[model samples]
Target: MDIRIKEAVDLFQEVMFYGTERVIKSIDDPLWKEFSPEQIQMLKLVSREKRITSSRLAALQAVHKSAISSRIKKLLQKDVIRFVQTEQQDRREKLVELTDRGKEVLVQSDKVLTDYIENLLAQHVNDEEIDQFLTIFRKLKDIIKADGVS
Candidate 1:
């Protein structure tokens, strides 16, 4: 590989690993004690989509529908998410939505992560640099989406 491409790949890997580790550590609070990391991730996805079918979520997560169903069952037992029947003619379609408690957990988690990221950025980067990074990141995201990488 070209030297520049190799360097970029290495930097990307390092940044992803370090940033994820720091964010996970920062959010290791009592607020999340009752939830596993996978469960929290599911909640975050549901929070974003508002309501999504288990099959769609399974596709997004690259897991089997059975796995998604099991996770949904657990979330249901915890009273964090509930199944809502869609009004489609099929009538068998169900979507998962966050309960009040799920929303509260997601909000608190976002606040914690946001605070951590803001403080980290404040310590290492200025406004212009942040804007530049965001622009580049979004462009990359768009390119990946366009390429059907996910």
Candidate 2:
């Protein structure tokens, strides 16, 4: 690979891996015991959609149905998620929604992560750099979306 390409790849790798690890570690707390990253992601999706089926969640999360099932089971046991019956032909089928506690956890986690990122960025870069980074990040996202990657 060209030297420029190699440098870009190295920077991307370091930023993604080391940068993400530092951010996550900065916010490590007791809530992590009850919720893994996967579970938190699933909960956020469920929170956005008033109701979502396990199958739909699996598809959205790009994981196997069994993997989603296991997470659902754990969430259910923790009382973080609950299943509600829809008025459909199959009563057995149910949609998942976050419980009150789940919502609280989600909200708390969002605040914690948001605060951590804000402080971290403030410590490392100025507002001007944030604006520039956001512009580039949004453009990169648009490019990825247009390319139909994933």
Q: What is the lDDT for 118 in model 1?
A: 92
Q: Tell me which residue pairs clash in candidate 1.
A: none
The CA lDDT at 44 in model 2 is 92
lDDT, model 1, position 133: 92
lDDT of 2 by residue, 37-75 (tens): 889889999998879999989988899999999999999
Q: Highest lDDT: which candidate?
A: 2
Q: Give the TM-score of candidate 2.
A: 0.74
Relative to the unseen true structure, what is the C-alpha lDDT of residue 72 in candidate 2, on a scale of 0 to 100? Answer: 98
Candidate 1 vs. true structure, TM-score: 0.79
lDDT of candidate 1 at residue 141, scale 0 to 100 = 93
Clashes of 2: 0
Q: Write the per-residue lDDT of candidate 1 for residues 59-138, one digit (tens) a residue.
A: 87779989888899889999999989998898799889999999998898778778878988899899999999999989
